[model samples]
Target: MTHKAIAFFDLDGTLLDDKSQVRPEIKVAMTQLKENNVLPVIATGRTEVEVAAIMKEANIDSDIIMNGAFIRVDGTVIFSDLYDKNLIEEVYSAARENNDAISFYNEKEIWCNEHNKFLLGAYNFIHTPVPPVNPDGYLTKPVNMLLILGQDNDNYYASKFPQLNFYRNTPFSLDTVKKTVSKGIAVKILQEKLGLTKVPSYAFGDGPNDLALFEACDIKIAMGNAVASLKEQADFITKKNTEGGIVHALKHFELI
Candidate 1:
């Protein structure tokens, strides 16, 4: 694209619709923007393989994924960060203490033990792959984040794994990662990598996990259907995700 400045977008709630397909309007706008030499960077919590396939499906050329852990623009690696091996082992062990309610993600694979058929079913909910690991245990490569499922023991992981980043998406879902990473941090990393100078980059999201990016950007738009606190922090609020809230927010920002 090689332009003056670029737009960084979140894939799930920002670009893709409820069905996880690229909407017609978004596809049109992104194509026009790309032609104008303005790059559209896909910045999301998804990893390289997942977002890469999505980009190919959408016919776009660039993205940063794994909440910024694995990044590539066109065919180049702008930057990438991996979890600390020691931390991965420690966090996995800690999660195991809570029963078999945890799943792990590095840039590549999603790992779960064979015993938790119900949790395994959750993998099918999103249609992402979960390959069995060496010991039916933690992943070989250290993961970027951990999604723990349960309620009562919320405080347990936080207390024991104080050095890690942990938060809740729902009462049954807990998300944890190394404290230094987030979609927000990933945005700045990409902005610099692409040599963009624009301030107050536009970002859209509907989860607490996106809070860091929300605060980090100059302009933040929370979806109308987002969590209570996220809506409160949004500089502007648009329609619901099902209604293509991101397209509305982008239009309001004049990017669409």
Candidate 2:
């Protein structure tokens, strides 16, 4: 509830570079923000295990992972949004028929039908290790998100399940979530829970999945290498990720 602002960063393309490493300048900037009492949170589409490693390596503690389906702060889970079982079935059926590789996300692990090109491609793109395949069926659990290795079928899913939202997060895959789920919603929840009413919110991202995140922030920053669509709506545009964009933007706003 103080004057300290909260900065949410998208991991893959905003904070991490092509090699999937956070730039030293960005890390230093975040450290400075910490000293100034500002909260720096990772808002990413990655799983908890991956996020755990990232946070440990980066020395960050809070995060909004799985594209806003999960929220963790000070090492405690404060919010989680799960998808409908019926809709999960619909996605599973469609993927099987189309020969698309699909993975389901729970709070603990990522399980897929099989290790295929599409799934591996996404892992490679994010510079993370390949996830395991567990075809044992994960329907009985609380599945928060789905990662499909295929083309966009947003319309089909939207028409079929009115409570779901879909978007292509990368060239090789699409991400699905409940209609009410998003990074923005997660941020709003965190803000309310923390009673940060007067503090400003800043978000940085570079993909279509980041659109909703942008909507939730007081200032939206688009990485220079971000998608054109995202750039159009940005409140500010900084350098490319590899060029120390995160640190550059923070300095530009004098947040650090």
CA lDDT for candidate 2: 0.83
- lDDT (Cα atoms) of all candidates against the true structure: 0.68, 0.83
What TM-score would candidate 1 get against the native? 0.85
TM-score of each: 0.85, 0.94
Worst 10 residues of 2 by lDDT: 151-160
Tens-place lDDT per residue, model 1, 1-256, is: 3574466776665577766677777777778766766677787766665565778766678776766566777878777677676776776676678674666666666665443654555445445565454433454556666666566676787788777667664445566766777777777787777666574466677877778878767778888777888888988988987797866776776764
Off by over 4 Å in 1: 115-118, 136-142, 149-151, 170-172
Look at candidate 2 and tell me the lDDT of residue 220: 97
Task: Give candidate 1's error at residue 136 in angstroms.
Answer: 6.7
| Top-TM-score candidate index | 2
Clashing pairs in 1: 200-218
